[model samples]
Target: MRTNSPETKKTARELRNDPVLSKEYTKNKIQFQNYYFKLGYQWSKPDLNSIVCRFAVLIQVIRIKREELTESFIEYDTRFLGGNFQIPDSKELLLLIFLNAPLYQVFTTLRKCSKRKEKYYKDRVGQRFEIQIGYE
Candidate 1:
């Protein structure tokens, strides 16, 4: 799924945000994939990664491991280092571990983005997902 790992060491924002921080790479630290770090932080979101990593192992899934979360499996099984994912899905739910969203914000980013019509939702504390179809 990720072929770009070997060619480029860091993501666009990492290079753009600060040229100086890249020097840390020279220290030979464990290398994580570009996609799975914290927003605005060149660091890995371990809690987030742990959720995916653990679940994957529990379900016996994934190419990367929980400890390293490396970019890829190197020749002779060396492994690159860290590998979190930057994709939208990774940021979501335990249903937020998968959705990266609160129940309300899944439809819209704003918590209060949608307001139910008073006529339809006046006193319905609990409602089903079904939408009513008007009579022809």
Candidate 2:
């Protein structure tokens, strides 16, 4: 698990020091805070390892004008796998394909809500299983 490594600290410090990036971060943080707070929820800093480590499910939070929102999982890499966790490449690929399939999307959408408009944001809120790809 890569948590608070020297490189991560350095990048975080750089982001904090950059005026433009800092401003954008603060703005987004505030928006997230406000939205969560309305639901009687408080935001906490995500675990560093969880951000950099582990395979995760990704869901679309925002809807496009004329597109369907689908659910997907991140691809796992052996190089990034550490400790006891072992996920095969083929398994990961299959999982991704299944999760992103139209059938799975329809199933999840149906299970979540009956309203067509509300389906988009059904599983989109709160903490999601999302992979943190690359450095910010």
Give the runs in model 2 whose Cα sits over 4 Å from its true position.
Answer: 27-136
Q: Name the lDDT value of residue 92 in candidate 2.
A: 13
Total clashes for model 2: 0
Q: What do the candidate models score in CA lDDT, each in turn?
A: 0.25, 0.30
The TM-score leader among the candidates is 2
lDDT of 1 by residue, 34-90 (tens): 322222122344353232211110111122223332234222122122542232232
RMSD each, Å: 23.5, 17.6
lDDT by residue for model 2 (1-136), tens: 3567998888889998997776443221111101111112123644443322222223433323211322221112112222122333221111111132222331011112224534433444332332223342
Where does candidate 2 clash, by residue pair?
none
| TM-score, predicted candidate 1 vs. hidden true structure | 0.13
**Count of clashes in candidate 1:** 21
